[model samples]
Target chain A: MVQFLQQIVNGLSLGSIYALIALGYTMVYGIIKLINFAHGDIYMLGAYVGFICTVQLGLGFFPALIIAMVTCAIIGVVIEKIAYKPLRNATRIAALITAIGVSYFLEASTQKIMGTSAHSFPDVLGTQTFNVLGVVISMKQIIIFVVTILLMLLLQYVVQKTKIGRAMRAVSVDADAAQLMGVNVNATISYTFAIGSALAGAAGVLVGIYYNTVSPLMGLVPGIKAFIAAVFGGIGIIPGAMFGGFFIGIVETLVTGYGSSLYKDAVVYIILIIILIVKPAGLLGKNVKEKV
Target chain B: MKKLVIALFVFAMLAGCSSNGGGNPAGDGYKIGLHYELTGEVADYGNAELEGSKLAIKLMNQKLGEDKYESVEYDNTSSTTEAVTISTKLVQDGVIGVVGPATSGASAATYQVLDGAGIPVISPSATANNVTQKNPDDENSEVYNSVFRICFEDSYQGAAMAQFAYDTLNAKRVVIYGDSTTDYAKGLTQAFTDQFHKLGGTVVATEYYVAKDTDFNGTLTKIKDMTYDALYIPGYYNEAGLIAKQARAMGIDCPIIGGDGFDSTTLVDLAGATALNDVYFTTAYTTVGASDALQAFIDAYKAEYNKEPGMFAALAFDATNLLMEACEKAGSNNPADIQKVLVDIEFDGITGSFSFDATHTPIKSVLVVELVDGVQASAVSVSPKM
Candidate 1:
């Protein structure tokens, strides 16, 4: 049905955002074995940074977005150095708690600075609709989908072919071994944060343009949902996060479209619960055998 | 030496006792506490409510003389727990009456504290019907009896919005998007559907989003395929603004109607001028005109704070005045007497006036305002048919 197809397109577009944010969560989890709770808040900061560049500084969309990505990358490195780096050998729980604290501190700071009001983002892509198979899709949605896919491919290529990418995988596998093999373990981890935060920043800009609104706490829900997507897809698995994000987005859309809208979020969480119950490791996560 | 010593001790004791009683006097004067949210996502709403209360207080003080009553204020900062804490502090401070805990959730939290202390608390904007609909025989019913409100319940506002869509806008079918987190949103959606269907309009589809959701494309896409005359979104400004922007971007292109939750400058700022064009919403009052009373309040507010008072300020002003009027009519600061007088008293307000019903819900006119280029242009007053 046209309606069904349209919903899928809509789902994919939203899912792409979730996918981008999920990658950040998955990568951090993959390397650090810690859920960076503040990752979402970093995405929020990215959006605000992009907002300031575009709205206040009068930069074009692309320039502002690039600046936002670079800014977030720097913030990511700083956060890692200041917050996570010091606790590199700390318990996972301690790192997680620190992440949460950082998240709260960032959200509170944004609220204080931004004054708890929603700011309208400048319309970058003109609001024009293109019809495909009796389904009307906006230019913004199309751009978001295309850009997300391109970014995902770029990430895949980077991880598979690049030197730093190998270093990241090596570090993830065995940080001590990688360090012994002359790999800069800390630099690799910082690089992972940089890439993850940049992706989150891009997601922020995309969402801001798509939603046409930005707020201090805008990143919180999407951040949580993206993390769910990462776990659902098998946390630490890059492609898995992509699949999971799209899956969650489509499922949410379908549930709200056909089922009771009130229970849509409930349905999404239920899916996550069911998926987790079925496969403790995740949909695509491998069962690791711990060496004695 | 004994007389001198006794005189000094008595004077010191008398001074201490007077200081304690002087905090709040009896029939000669009264203390009314205002608990409102001054910060957070709904800060604008709280700010408006506070402003209205302030204006009302100024008028009451001017009419009754400042010596007749005293007013104190507390900011709940848009937290339910804070509302409870503030209400406890206010009651401890011996406020004879209290006004506002703005939102329904905050009101629910403060109700227990204020009701336990036998203080009459009235909210100008807390419209959840259940807030005042307590079981008469239940022990908790005491809270409901002491609480009152100036705004009509969502039941009326929802029905009014539905009627406007069906009769005025002549929409044949409507799609409803509701925010499920707040009782205000759910209540309005229910009312809109019940009244719209009752009036022979078909609700093609209904969607929902949470308070924190920024994406509505999935839901909007579903509705885009369906033929609908108008979209009814019953949600607060935060989500509503995003919904409006995304809805427009999706090419749904139907008029959107909402409730007082949409009466925020933030909504326009969030939605943008192009997106918010032709949007209609309902509110308790409007700041468009300079009516004699409104102008005077505005002048006083500007003189005091050097800024134009928003709608919440006007409502708070009226609420304060209403309490003072009740006190004067009762000729006492006793909570029970003032409560009875509040229920029966009807005075002209900036927005207009009606006495409270048994539920403490005011029977007043609702204003339907149209957003013209990001500003409220026209306001029409609608009263319940009953």
Candidate 2:
């Protein structure tokens, strides 16, 4: 029972990270209805920015994290403005291809600048284990969990109460109606990207702290997983993204703990495929009536 | 006027003949090709091997003093297909010998190219046992003659590490993890498990991860439930670093052991100082406890590159020096002559004294290193019992 509780705590901490990253994926999908593949590369960029700010420029973790978030937010806005916004009327495939092109370009450029070797992120928190009811948890895991929850709650408040949040919902439901209601549709899209990119930045920092390493290609797996989480919880649904992230994390952890570790990834994908087949709209997604 | 024209013509003819002599000579200006993975996942390994070849060529030219020989370099992109393409290009360029494909997988792909050309190929780091292990009765056995390795085979390293874990650390039950994508990981894991079980140790659990995976929570949880004395992760530093960190996070506190792939400083940095404490691995050489010659090489390397030489660099340096020694002993620019000399030659290297065994693998001592606060310290030498 003690071991079971310990694994749960571990799973929760990991799930929180996935939640932060998945929020970025789901948020963008809600507003734009396009899977921004470059979103993951933005996370990688955040890690590199944090690395440079902290290790090279000698800033503290909080300050470096803020700078990383702001920098990534700006890049996100620019990318949406230049790449996606221009192709809004084009086929969805065009936008998808552009996203992929942008992702590859970012990865290659970063690799060229940073070299192909993995860089060591500085340890912001000291390595000291704290015990909680016969389960020892590291200080880093606690911080990651706390930060993730705080960010999620803050996002929830923004989307539920704020006027801009209403505008975002309006845009998601019907872009023409939102513009008719005096909402600056383009501005709302940019704001959505800014918020999503900032969240991804935070996720990148948490991952670096948890794993103790950063690489140019490090964002690929988590990025894909977060997208899966978005789809699993119901794409375009806020609470759904959170639920999916935690669910995937727990299921993957349980599978690895109980079954063969080699089958962990296989299990995650199989669950996604099965869920999709049974309920195409995802766990919390609504079924839409086709105009045709 | 006729006599003056004859003299001028003779002078022009002599100059043309001398320029042609400088360009090419019959069986004199031998070309040695190098195929390495200079880019991709294992680029670091390829870069080190290439640097070693460069250093060897510099030393050899200095020793030769204007000898008519040239080295041609090619990038193999760490892919089998690329290695094959590069080997064919090298053969087309009329290289008498080739230095490396840097990995067993790549070497296996390009084996036919060099074998068909009858050009001897030597690898600086390819450690797979089957690389040179040929079927004696088969007509294609001659394909094995053209290939050799400067590093110890996986069998030697596996058994050596297992014995160290069993006898030195008294580890009775060990868990094994490997990367499924790499032959290096698979070969080392198989060898270690075989030797450990043979020595009456139980493999409590065995797991695997892909080459680029960053998470190990699932695998770590399973291993944590069991009672294992040690964890053997025979894979490269990229994934190994994350595994070490995640294993610690999951509360699997057993000491993790690995092979030469863990020699990168990046591993220490990736795993963090606290998590890497007590982690052990086997490597070719360490900057600490180096021989006098090895120390000089390190000093020169530091002076040249403005950084300490890692184990890959040291292995490469040794390989180059060994190749030069073979060239000198052969006293000819002929591939067959160099091949013959290489088989019988024994010389002290930066890592240790290296000589070829019957399988064309190097016979040398392997060093066991312990990680102290994310830095490699306390290196001890081990030799295979056989």
Candidate 3:
């Protein structure tokens, strides 16, 4: 029981980071119907930015995090403008392939700039673990969880109440119709990219603090898993993405704990298969007609 | 497009001209081909080896000033393709033998070409047993007879450490966590597990993660409640350092043991000073109490590079000088004669006394080092039991 609870805490902490990344995938897919595969590299960029700030510039942790978020948000807009906007009318496959190309380019460029070695992140928060009822809790874990929740709440507020959020939903539903309704679909799309990329950047900084190392290609696996989470929760559904990310994290941790660690990744893909077979629309997704 | 064609044609002609010197010498000095990763993922290892080889060549030239050799060096960038390409170029360049390609994977990738071309290749620190031993993945599964390494095979490391754990530390229960992708890590893990069980030790659990996965929280959390006398991690410094930090944070109090992969100074740098307590690894050399010659080499290295030499550098120095000695003894820089001479040569190296076994693998003792306050303090020298 205590062991189970400990695993849950571990799961939640891991899941929250995944959720933050999943939100990016979900948001971009919602607006443009493109699975911005380069989103994860944005996360890596965020970590490096925060790394430069905290390690090189001697900035505080929160300030570094904010700077990373802002920089990545701008980068996101620029990437969409240069890479995606031109290919908007092209085939979806072409855009997806370009997303992958962009991802590889970002990875190679980062590796060239900062050697492929993993840099040890300095302890921004003092290293201290408190044992509560035989379960260990660290400051990084608490901060990661709390920040993720608060960010999600802020996201919910923006989506539910803000005019930009309304435009975002309008564009996601039908871009032509949203343009007809004077939503300025291009601006909405750029705003969506900014928010999504900013979230991924925040997740990147949190991971650097939690894991104590950052590398050029660190975003590849986490990015893939977050994409899987988006798909598992129904792509383009925001709340469902959070649910899926958390679920994947908990299940992955539990599988590793009770069963073989070797099977952990295999089990996640297996669950994805089962989910697709059972509910193609996902838990929180709805079936909608599409125009060919 | 025409310019590109012209450039490629010029490159091919230059390559063809170099092939004219294959397996033969013309000048007063012999040419030796060198491949080291100056830039890449493991560039640190490559760069250190590069410095050591350079220093060794310079020392040899000073001693035999008139007969000093010229080395043709190339950067493989730690890529297997580049390693093979450079090895091919080296053979074509008519080098007597090649000194290094740095890591085991890179060395293995170049072996097939070097072996078929009958070129003798000695890697300074490639420790995977299959480098000279039979690689099951090979098309013929035959030993690459031309391949040799200066460092002790990884299997010996695992077995020696397990024996020490069982006999010295009285660790009857242990858990193994290792990298699954690389042959070096897998070979060590298997050897350790076999030797541990043979010594009446029970391995409570064995876990694995690929190279990229940084977070070991899930695996550590599972082991949190389990009873184990020690934790054995056989992987590179980057992952090992992080694992040590995360394990310590999770309140694991057991002694963590590792292989030569933990030899890098970055291990201490990454794992943090406070978390280094009880961390131990089996490595090549410790300069704490060394012979005057070894101390001299260390001093020279520091003076030249303004930094301490890592194990890779030390191994490379031995590799280059040892090959130089073989060339002198054979009275020729011919690859075949050098290969024959290398089998019988017995010499003292910076790392240890080196004598080739039947397979050209060095017979040497492994030094165990412990981390205290992020410093590698020498522990014990574990020799192979007779």
Ranking by TM-score: 3, 2, 1
DockQ computed for model 2 against the true two-chain complex using alpha carbons: 0.24
Off by over 4 Å in 1: B1-34, B37-44, B47-79, B93-97, B133-145, B274-278, B288-290, B295-313, B320-347, B372-375
Two-chain DockQ for each candidate model: 0.29, 0.24, 0.35
Docking class of 2: acceptable
Label model 3 with its docking quality class: acceptable
DockQ, candidate 1, vs. native dimer: 0.29
Put down candidate 3 lDDT per residue, A140-187, tens digits, no spaces: 899999999999999989987999999999999899999998889889
Candidate 2 residue spans exceeding 4 A from truth: A81-90, A174-186, B1-34, B55-77, B88-99, B117-120, B132-142, B242-255, B272-278, B321-347, B370-386
Lowest-lDDT window of 10 residues in candidate 3 chain B?
A: B20-29
The stretch of ten residues in a row with the least summed lDDT in candidate 1 chain A is: A108-117
TM match of model 2 to true structure: 0.85
Residue B244 of model 1 has an lDDT of 88
TM-score of each: 0.85, 0.85, 0.88
- Rank order by DockQ, top first? 3, 1, 2
Q: Which digits, one per residue and each the tens of the lDDT, describe model 3 over residues B183-225?
A: 8899899889889888789999999887768789899988877
Per-model CA lDDT versus the true structure: 0.82, 0.80, 0.84
- Stretches off by above 4 angstroms in model 3 are A180-185, B1-86, B89-96, B133-142, B290-308, B320-334, B384-386
Q: After superposition, how far is residue A123 of candidate 2 from its true place, in Å?
A: 1.7
